[model samples]
Target: MSPRPSSPTIPEGRDSDGVDFRNVVGILARRRNWVFGVPLALCALVVAYLLVAHPAYTGTAQVFVDPRDQYTPKDDPLQNSVPGDGLLLVESQLKIITSNEVLNRVIEQMNLQNDPEFNGERVGLGRLVKALIGLGKPEDRALVTLRNLRKKVTTRRIDRSFVIDILASADTAPRAAALANAVATSYLEEQAGANSAFQRRTSEAISAQLGKLRQEVKRGEEAVAAYKAANNLVGARSRMVSEQQLDEANTQLTNAKTRLADAQARVRLIETIEHGDAGLDAVPEAMQSAAIVQLRGRLADASREEAQLAQIDGPNHPALQAARAQVRDVQAAIQRELKTIARSVRNTYASERTNVQTLQANFDALKTQSQANEKLLVPLRELERKAESSRIVYESFLAKAKTAEERQGIDTTNIRLISRATTPENKSWPPAMIMLAAAIFAGLTIGIALALARDYFDRQDRGPEPDAVAEPDVPARAAAEPAPAFRPAVIAQHHAGRLSALSEDLLAAPQGHTMVLVQVQRAAWLDDVALQLARAVIANEMDVMLVDADLARHRTTSRLGFDKAPGLRDVMAGIAAINEVVQLHKPTAMRIVPVGLSAVAERDPRARQALSLAFRQLRDFDRVIVDGGEMGSTASEFGLYYLADEVVFLAQGPGGKSEDAAILVDLLKLRQVKARVVFVEPDVSVAA
Candidate 1:
């Protein structure tokens, strides 16, 4: 057997089969017409459009958005529904300026439907073409005219302010200006009308409420009056008659108490004089007796006469005896008068006591009546308070109703036209300069894309070389040791079974060999190819190991439903023993290692270095088949290329010849790495 070539690494640009930027620039230069002409042609078209399109003149009018009567503590309900702050209010007002109400007014005022700019007049070649095609109709024209009129009217709000601009476009400058002014005027009028209507409604509501409140006040006043009458609480200035009566009763009670004490003292004094040893002469009653006084005076006179008689005549003389008798008679008369005085004093005491009892009784009865009246006054006073409150509420509502009625006829719109629209001097739509720049930019971009696409297709048509060579698909890696040159072993469809044919190619190689199975194009039956190869190995009665290296789409693992099973990632991360994760394919009894989700394992720098050891461990098996993901792009597959002894390319059919695989083959040949190809054709059977 010929000596195996050393594996090659990716080469620098000019020395290997790879696309270079210099070549891409050259291809663009050759197709200069496509790159430059497209942009110029597009710019010409933009000029043509500007010339043929009817110029639309635009006019603008400015208005303030402040609501009227800000100090009234009332809000415009319609305005309040819109947001209140900064951009939101501005945006809402902008919508209102373009509202149907305002626009319809503008449309009617300008008679835009009859205007040619809006009504679709047949002016140019396009109109003639449409007429020839039988596309233009009167009804369609009316609808289109209305739609165009609406589209021509636009509004914008000035930033950081409460100003909105109403803009209208028309065929003539004066017409556009008139339409704009009309729209602004109509909006202002509508706003004023709305405010007036709102106030009218508000006044109506307040009037209704005022009527109810008036009835309430009347009822409250009536209740207060009825309570006052029922309780007999007639008085001056909030004080009731019963309260004054109570005061009078208290004063009488105090006076009666004083009188009763005085009467009792007098009665006791009289009793002392009559029943005790006190003298009648010492008594005030005896001192005031007229009969007693007379008796005393007479006794004194008779005593003096008896003294004169005794001195001149005998003791038993008739004149002296008469004097003595006269004195005794006077003394007896004085005694009778004292008894009469005592009886009269007792009678006076009894009469005074009776008067005191009558006064006390009268005072007590008045006091009881006053206290009972006081209890009734509580609810009556409450009724009075309610009456006052209802009166106050009624007055307040009446005042508000009057205010509302006064404001009902007042228009409260603050929206004023700051600037009226004037005739536009120039057209607004189809800005010449901006359209030209945009056309140039867009044309350049499309032109460049087409140029690159054309170059790529041309390269593809040229195809790869007939002689196969191993090449690197990855970026060039620095050489550690010089590598030998190698030849490629290209495999095509054979009469033998593709699987059995692949098996023979491997069996013919040195024993216990490792190879990477890569598809020339993606999704070229990679899983089916891997399975068939495993079965071929099993048929030969040799143990084989299948390592699924495809992390993107784990076709091998999914087909066998071993998605969750531990496989390449687990082994690489040292989380599982190789034997534990390796599942045996029952049909072929082949050992298959699944590719699990091991992002951390693939990211580690040590994972690639550990591959040699992993391959050595699998030396016990007769063969190791690694599903080396995609051909050119996968970094893991590029690393696997160095670890495997040889590489096998699986092409789907005649259409499966990828330029990427060709480049990779050339890179492999430069490094002297053994590589081969296996073509898989559809609807054909092969033998072993």
Candidate 2:
């Protein structure tokens, strides 16, 4: 027969034979309806909708915004749209195409106010219900139609390109195509109208400036004419009268000074000749005289005749005397002519000096008059410059105004339609394959979550399964001494089933120390039950310890064959350590701490604190079963009661009226402990 038996404990999972996959499969199989049901219903609805719903048609049109075509007619800069803004122009035109101004044009042209899809008008019961609830304020019919048109019409620019696509959706194909084309036409018309209006405004702006500029030019010219008259600045050929007179005076004065200088030089030369410092011929005045030349010629002829006669005849010769007399006569004539030429030069020099003084006076007067006229001309010249500037500006404005007027009739928007919309053959929404796939995915996700959630909650509702752990046999104790008032064989054999249940409840947790207050008067009974509970806990693979806390008699110490062992009391009194006093029972592998021989457990004031320290240290063991003796009058001795996880009140008969035990139970509320009480009645036949 097997020595080990089964005891009740909590189990972790299913039986060892079952795998995790099967366990999960069983849990989900129970909730198959949720896992498969939702997707089927959603798919059925989608299929029915695809069959019954109206088949929608989408029409598409393409517009090309030709930025390269500036279309500027004149020099007016505003004639062309912002062509330099390439990508920016495309984006701005997108907004303009969607604006109310363009959409209203389309609505009026196509008469979309009467179209059912665009009008968004509700009739019958739905309108009445909305009116009663005030869902939205009543709006103009045109506004509602415009809003619906805006919603149905879609516009997008092709990727990094100059083409824009306009899409419109409707119930029928023809109406959809017409709607798309109308929107494109409306946008182009809006752009053209914008250009025409801008040209007109520009013409008006330039005209507004023309009159003011003209007035400015007129005022400038008049001021220049008035200034010229006031300052006496009239002139000929762009020069003042004083300026011409000053030029003539300066010329005459310069010529007079030159003639005077020449006359003075000639007069000085004649005086030098008269003083014999120079010859008469050496002076130009003398050399230019006719009388001096003729006299010198006659002297030269007579001297030549005398030289020939002196060579031919003696000193008394007639021709030589005649030549001497002729030479003296010619010298007298030459001297007379030289004096006449000198007088003529002095007179000429005097006349030239007088002429120079008169001309100098005239030139000075003309210079003063000319300088005064030049000062007056400064303001007149400034006024003339202002008049010229005003005329130039007026002409510029006049040119701009003419250009603006000419361009008013011409439209220069470069946007044009490239492709017209065609009737679509297929609907855009409610794709059957995609909806079916989505429905399946959603159903699987929801079903799996619900199945797992239900399984988890069911497991929580049922309690945990009990573990099949081995139970220790309460074998008969071999004793050499006679037994006390408590019989171990009787209680161990008959009360084990009942005591095992109590021990399981008290020691549910397999870790830490549990001080169980056993209110039994008999010391032998404490030893038997503490040993029984400890041995039972050991079968579950735990370390169990026992402490004999009965102070008056150390009977449990002796029964466990540790009569001479130093124990908890000696450790409390500082006589022996807990390790030296503790004894192990070899048969059950149970450990015990018996009361020592030299210490008193009843009267020590520090006994409770020292014992609490001892219990706190014993938490290293899995279960420490404390054999607290019977309840006494003082709570100071029963301090372990506060630390106990439970209280097993063993009385031997019907539970006795022990007020000490009741008071101890009441005081346990200080620690807020929910103590488990197990009342035991001794079986008389088993005891006998």
Cα deviation at 287, candidate 2, in Å, is: 14
Residue 101's lDDT within candidate 1 is 75
Q: Whole-model Cα lDDT per candidate?
A: 0.68, 0.70
Q: Write the per-residue lDDT of candidate 2 for residues 568-622, one digit (tens) a residue.
A: 7787776766777788777667788987776544545466556656776776777
Q: Which lDDT tens digits does candidate 1 get at residues 488-573?
A: 11111221254666778777765567878876555323346666676567767777898887776666677666788888777666
**Backbone clashes, each candidate:** 17, 1
Off by over 4 Å in 2: 1-30, 48-52, 66-85, 121-139, 235-382, 454-688
Candidate 2 Cα deviation (angstroms), residue 322? 15
Best by lDDT: 2
Superposition error at 208 for model 2 (Å):
3.3
